[model samples]
Target: MTQSGFDTDRPVRLGVQLAPQHHDSYQVIRDAVSRLEDMGVDILFNWDHFFPLSGDPDGTHFEGWSMLAAWAEQTERVEFAALVNCNSYRNADLQADMARTIDHISKKGGETGRFIFGTGSGWFERDYTEYGYEFGTAGQRLDALAEALPRIESRWAQLNPEPTRDIPILIGGAGEQKTLRLVARHADIWHSFVSPDELPHKLEVLSRWADKEQRDTSTLVLSNELGRRDEAEARKLHDAGVRLFTHGVSGPDIDFDSVQRWLDWRDGING
Candidate 1:
């Protein structure tokens, strides 16, 4: 049961964040995408960043959206997106249009495009500073995200062929005041980095925000990172209501063994 003392009918899903960093060849990432989809993970994520987020500060890193476009064409079954696309990096309407185009690219034989629009308020200052965007306050970024989301949705409505489906919006962050409120109003998935002990309070706050927004909280899927988590801890997290879990894998090389472990865990949990 969750913090709300209930269980959801939603099936468990596994996502892996394939960081577009520390790689010499884009082909390495391309190959990783093909193998991961074949391995049966449900979702694939690449973060929106200009440079390597870990290891060497100046290591080779690829831009995220273009890689996502490649992923859209490369993988058939798995949904893909930026783990959390930064709201500060692009124009809202333009973001919408780009997403719509990718949505079309991922379509197969009338199946809706396999894209998830996971987004967040911009946080990494280097991405903004190096790219010539203003590195504003966190609150301002959050406010910008809140404003831009509606514009994105509106633009999607006017697009030519339209998104293959109502592309699910996944919002990352657990800030109760602004982030949770935004999640209540807009997110289909709420991804958090907090520990299981902290999730209940956040969910309680989300419940309040959902009430304020007059939205049903039950439809909201909770997602958490599975980095360094063992099965017992993961089960605790699952009981606390997180159904979607994503483990991050970085390059020079993708961790196929760890990916297999997660798939095994996903199957075990679902069964």
Candidate 2:
């Protein structure tokens, strides 16, 4: 493991979150996934929500897990998952089984599956309200997530045909108290939206939590968003210990201009 907690030998990876909103047809989204994989993106992600996150609230949208299942059959190389599934949407055991099933679906040519289980406590009140789930307090939701993670792991163990591989668990959010502690305890990757300036402090806190939990967090991968950051900014983030960078692209018409720049940057770094 590197000093930053990620395996030093592993090259920097690029991920794109194709927000499953504002698209008129699944074919268009499916084409986009193929384009991304062809472009050599290491990971592909979609958000978990019932409605659009941007533009009109009731715009055209597709559910994340279903889309992921399609992606499993659609692409051969890209690792994919919900950017973060809402823990409150389904039972923990069910979620584990679904993840395992998708993991198997993604396998090809004697290769292990390429599925990552990225999840967190549900936060979008609109999803809960419209979907008929109680929009409980944030703390309450986090507590539920804390309780469910272990059960998810246990269920994975009990499944008849286990996951093709130890499906990586990526916990998203930057809540210093509950979220980070949970990340330390259960996550293989910790995704945060914190800005580059704030990352050092947050990582310090994560390290402290790992020490308290007695886990060797040096193997944990740090993830962050690409947004509008340029190469210099990305380098700073890399220097600060982040190796996995994801950029969100929304649709109607999807753009790959920025994604290409980031991919080029990643290639330069890896080379």
Candidate 3:
């Protein structure tokens, strides 16, 4: 494990968010999934949204949880989840049940499962408008998320056969006051969007939050986007305590050439 400035001695792990949008066919996504797991990537992710976020507003898109269930049966190793599930879209207890079912399906024969519950307070208003959910204030949404997480955990515990393993809660976002505090209290993994330079400060804030929440920051895995970052920036982030680096890819026909560089970089660090 690489020694970051923080108390994290975790191994470097590579992840990719395969955007489930703009795909003309689902077969393209299936092939990409096979390739990513074969490439020895550590995690797989897809976003939770009703429409495309890039290219075309009306482009073809697939639902997140549905694909996640398929991934549960399809892949054998890599952990998978929505890049960040919108808590506003579904009932908290229902989300817990859905995740548990997927957890059960992901197991081959062992007692463990590879489902990461990556979620966030939603930001896309069109999804709310079309889906008939109220487009509430950001604070309200975050509050809802805060309220829902406990219910989800309670539901997990009450389920017939509890989740194969503690489904890792990966909370994504970097807002100092609310999001980071939630991450400190609940998240097993904290995925950040801030740049390398800003990471130290954000982490400092998170540390403070952890202290306040009576949680140890060392128990949380730090994640960051690997797409726009150069190797130097990535190393900088790594030094700051980030262990899980994620790059995102979109598809009709997805390519792996760009991703190969990240894989090699990850191997170089973890090898």
Candidate 4:
């Protein structure tokens, strides 16, 4: 797999979100991983949520890190991660150690860049309160994330056998005051839940912040969720210079057919 950067040969990439919450989970995700890799999807993402974001409030949900570990071992091609790992769930050091473990799993047979550490300041109130963690204010969580990112980066270096490649950091959020600014400084990939009309302004702001930080705006992998399965919509984002497009499906019994269609579209566009 190619390491994501300004010069990656692929002009656009498509990823699928296997929502760990609200799923048959174990089997649903396991099968999904192999199928996606076989179908040639670029990345597999699972949201970090303790409770099902949709469906029953008390539905079965698997933990993110462990699922990712399994995915690392199970799949040979696709890169995987929590679409946005909740920063409030684990300490910085522990998260780094877990990431290192996953990196090893993905590279067991040989070195392959099949993991991306996508993280964010957690927003769900239920996750923290139910898990006995402090449900601090948004600002507090973002501050913790800003501090933790460097530590996670440092810990990767400290590991005896380093990652297969420089583990790319994917940060998610659109908070202009804090999140986007941090993205400008630290993110290898920045994901946002924004509408088509709103993206141009956010891109401009991100570009300005990159200028101030002396970072190349193009260096950041711009990712966003595809709200609908419209080819034109995906192309619109690509035209705006967004290269990574993501679509999500819940489990219990996922419809991989739709995801396959998106993958086809991705290939057709890039081809």
What tens-digit string does per-residue lDDT give for candidate 1 at 198-232?
A: 88888888888988999987778889999999989
Assess each prediction's global lDDT (C-alpha) against the native. Answer: 0.90, 0.90, 0.90, 0.82
Off by over 4 Å in 1: 5-7
Indicate the residue-level lDDT of 232 in model 2: 84
Q: Which model, 1 or 4, shows the larger TM-score?
A: 1
Tens digit of lDDT per residue, candidate 2, span 1-271?
1246554446799999999999999988999999999999999999899999889988999999999999998889899989999999999999999999999999997569999999999889989988999988999999999999999999999998998998899999999999999999999999987887898789889889988999888778899888877788878878777889998898898988878888998999999
Give me the runs in candidate 2 sitting further than 4 Å from their true place: 1-8
Q: Model 4, poorest ten-residue lDDT window? A: 1-10
* Model 3 lDDT per residue over 1-271, tens place: 2434354676789999999988879999999999999998899999999999988899999999999999999999999999899999999999999999999999997769999999999999999999999988999999999999999999999999899998999999999989999998999999988887788779788888988999977678989998788999899888778889999999766769877889999989877
The TM-score measured for candidate 2 stands at 0.97
- Expressed as tens digits, the lDDT of each residue in 1-271 for candidate 4 is 2222332344788888888766654786787778888989889998778788888889888888888888888888788878989998999989998888788888856656578999999998988998999988999999999999989989999998887788888999998888888888888888877766677788778777777888875578888898663788667767666778888988677888898888888888888
RMSD of each: 1.3, 1.5, 1.6, 3.2
lDDT of 1: 0.90
Better of 3 and 4 by TM-score: 3
Please state the error at residue 183 of candidate 2 in Å: 0.7
Locate the minimum summed-lDDT window of 10 residues in model 2: 1-10
Q: Judging by lDDT, tell me the better candidate of 3 and 4.
A: 3
Listed per model in order, the count of residue pairs whose N, CA or C atoms clash below 3 Å is: 0, 1, 0, 1
